[model samples]
Target: MKKRIVSLAMAACLVLSMMVTLSACGGKPTLEEYYNSDAMQTIITAAVSQYEAQGVECSVTASGDELRYDFTIDIQTTEEERAIYAETLESQMPADYQEFIDEAKSIKESVSNETVTVVVTYYDADANVLYTQSYSSDG
Candidate 1:
């Protein structure tokens, strides 16, 4: 009777271990799933609100693993001004740019192992492209 009880207990333990292992192997989310998740939407909404509060119209979208940010400035500017803006961006990214990138990478890593690409485009009031920047997690 004692041997039978021990064998049954071992069998139960084995079954439980197998169940745990199988559940853990459920697989990571696809890029589309990550983008369409409520968490991603919340992040996008917050970003839009932050930029809008600063008088810039901002919209964010995701296609595959690429996240795009479109910002429209309220005022029109000359070609010289656009050139200067682009030069400044090339020299130094925005104060919060690295922070934003880190956050995005963290979120992406949590959901999938795929690379995440971020594209930011700035536009004037007339929808003229001012400056554009791209970043990739693979870097």
Candidate 2:
């Protein structure tokens, strides 16, 4: 009976250790870490400079396994200009980071005469979008 009890305890300890290891491996990237990464910030700065926009702002939020990127650019742009800007933004994404944009689960873009907003969100593992919102000068 004592031998059986000792074996059970050993099993429990093994299970607990496995749980801790899995939790550590499951750690997701934080918004701040993503935003501050040199690769990500460089792409944003490049887009802002290419468009000659006033400024570019970025935010990242996560819920469970979902990750979202919200970018706002201040610029006076017409409908046509907005389209071009969007293209330029995509092009500015670094080769190594293109997967982030390409694999986005949902992409939402909004443009007005004075401001442009782009929100690209995706699941952490598969890059699936949950929600999207976009606007244009025509609307």
Best model number under lDDT: 1
Q: How far off is residue 33 in model 1, in Å?
A: 2.1
Task: Please state the error at residue 54 of candidate 2 in Å.
Answer: 9.5
* Cα lDDT tens digits for candidate 2, 7-37: 4465445534544553576642343443344
TM-score of each: 0.69, 0.33
**Candidate 1 deviant stretches above 4 angstroms:** 1-25, 94-97
lDDT per prediction? 0.70, 0.41
- Model 2 stretches astray by more than 4 angstroms: 1-54, 94-139
Instruction: Please give, for residues 77-107, the per-residue lDDT of candidate 1 as tens digits.
Output: 8888888877876677677578558755754
Worst 10 residues of 2 by lDDT: 105-114
Model 2 residue 106 CA deviation in Å: 20
